[model samples]
Target: MAVRNADISVRRGEVIAITGQSGSGKSSLLYCLAGVLPVARGEVRFDGRVLGALDDEELSALRRERFGFVFQYGELLPELTVEENTALPLRLAGQRKGEALATAGAVLSRLGLGELRQRRPSQVSGGQSQRVAVARALVHQPAVVFADEPTGSLDSANATAVLEEFLTLARSQGTAVVLVTHDADVAGRADTHYRMRDGMLAPFTRDAS
Candidate 1:
């Protein structure tokens, strides 16, 4: 999807949900803001620095050191154990193996997956896998997290469970989140909601509920 114009501000610890159908430019806007994709027009700024202005190294460093991402599928590495996967971002950032795994274990415990940390992605249920993904995204205590259709693959009960934990952890750590989903129930969980259609964005209201 081509995102022509998308402008929004996300404050510290804020949860912003953008609801749009597939091909409605939701992911485009998200990747643009996360600095994964460059905007064609206008600018995307994080902490007063224009993303486009940053050189490749600077951008790479910024993304590595400060940003986090979670996709619809949880995208856990099938080869890695849950603990290993959750500790990956920290590992990539050069933290010691023991320290990273310990931290990951703590996060997994908090999310009620302590025992399952040793299990591989293929061994866990869909919801548990997504929680592991959330654990990974929050393990680094990033400035912001970008989640795309985070609960889209789960049943309603599992979806609610994962969403609640995701929001609770992010808010407690003062980490802002930008969530893009097609589900209204999930969108309503956000502090602010926006509707995206044909690449246009608008505030959503209860009347539209």
Candidate 2:
């Protein structure tokens, strides 16, 4: 799935949705923009720097220091406690264990998981685990969060809760969001929505709901 001529420009603190069927290249475009995948031809610029031109170490630093991510599954470590799992990014970025855990605890509290900090990922419900994932993603307050099918595994109510929390945090922190989903409701919640087809993206039109 190769994306060509993609000209997406996400504004600060904006919520942008990209919707498509499975294997429609939506995630590929995201990976390219995020610097996870190499841009074969065109340039991917972030904060006015060309991602393709950056060296490996610089790219790694950029991702570590400026970006956040959420996936379809919570992807929390099974052995680590919820707090530890949420703080893993900070820990990897050289934060002390005590301070990382403290920050993680505060973010968890904001996500309504203050009481479940000691539990492992397997010990929590799916919805709770996903909320924890959200906490982990935003704990570092990255410039942008790239969420791919973030609420796909949850039921409607839980999905709503997760999306609401994401929006609230993004609004308060002025972080941007790039959400990829096939669900209309999920896409509808974003300020701007586009449908991906054959490696191309076009504006999404709302139908009577």
Candidate 3:
């Protein structure tokens, strides 16, 4: 198979969906865009900067300062409470521990997770854990957020709830959201949808007739 290239320009406050079949390279594309994967033959850009131009240290800094991520599984630290887990990024960014914990509390409140702030990940439901994950992703107020199959493991109701929360929060906060998923219902909620096939991306359209 030939290597493929895809580019997307997302405005602040917009949500973009990336959809593709298995083996179509959606995950690889996301990694490249996020600067987590080295670009050997092509370039990825974000906010006018070429991702491939940054060294690993620079890229790590950029990722921490500008990007947030939500994965399919809620990767909360096993030993941390909800508040601590949500506050990790802020703490890493040098916020004072007290301030970071306070900020985390506020975000958790916004996500309806306030009551679970002291609970460990093992004590929460999957949906609650995912909401905590979302809080962690946004606590630093990143310019862009990338979610890879964020709701993939949830039941329909839980997935819908998570997607709705993500879209609402991102739009209200003017954060650009790029999500990769295989589900049409999830893709349908995006402002722009693209399908990855044969290593390239194309606009996704439905037959109106």
Candidate 4:
């Protein structure tokens, strides 16, 4: 079993961090909670509804409308400009292109990418690309964001920059965040911390300053 007997609850607007070594089930737990993976024997709830009870279309709607995601690498479509990439979620949700692009532009500006909005992923630095990924994730004003090793591909400085901006925006907007990483420094920024080992999760006490 990848994860067993773990009970995790996240309050609205809270930031939670999960840390563990590779193959320790941290990411598995995240996937289960995010409804990206089916649970074999447990319940995953969101907004008071059991995720497993939801049909595939319901689950898909939930993900598209309420949740955002960021991965280790910035997963941007190479052909799209930063603005276009950031506006994708809104577009998928049936927003008019002009309106979606406008919202995307505002978010990119908020992330200090106002000048780079027209650039494609290939034209930007890794950090900038990651920041754009973040912009895309937040453009829809998702209630929660799931980040899996979000800073893994960046250098120290870029990682720090991207994370700072990400948390700042999430906090300002009261968006909950679930961040999975193996880095202590990254986890330190969360309001709550947990460590996964041997397919189990337990609270780990540490100053979150």
Residue-by-residue lDDT tens digits, candidate 3, 1-209: 23376767888888999898877888877877788877678778887788888788888889997899999998999999999999999988889999999999999999899999999999999999999999999999899999999999899999999989888887888999999999999999999999888777888867410
Model 4 per-residue lDDT tens digits across residues 1-209: 38998999998789999998899899999999999998898899998999999999999999999999999998999999999999999999999999999999999999999999899899999999999999998889899999999999999899999999999999888899999998899999999999988889999855421
Q: Arrange candidates by TM-score, highest first: which order?
A: 4, 1, 2, 3
Tens digit of per-residue lDDT, candidate 1, span 126-185? 999999999999999999999999999999999999999999999999999999999988
In angstroms, how far off is 190's CA in candidate 4? 0.2
Backbone Cα, N, C clashes tallied per candidate:
0, 0, 0, 0
Query: Which residue ranges in model 2 land beyond 4 Å of their true spot?
Result: 207-209
Model 3 accuracy (lDDT, Cα): 0.88
C-alpha lDDT score of every prediction, in listed order:
0.93, 0.91, 0.88, 0.93
What is the lDDT for 104 in model 3? 97
User: What ordering of candidates by lDDT runs from best to worst?
Assistant: 1, 4, 2, 3
lDDT of 2 by residue, 1-209 (tens): 87867789988899999998787799999998899999788798899999988999999999988898999998999999999999988998999999999999999999899999999898899999999999998888899999989999999999999999988987688899999998998888999998887888778765512
Question: How many Å off is the CA of 177 in candidate 4?
Answer: 0.3
Q: Which model is ahead, 1 or 2, in terms of lDDT? A: 1
Off by more than 4 A, model 1: 206-209
Residue 113, model 2: lDDT of 95
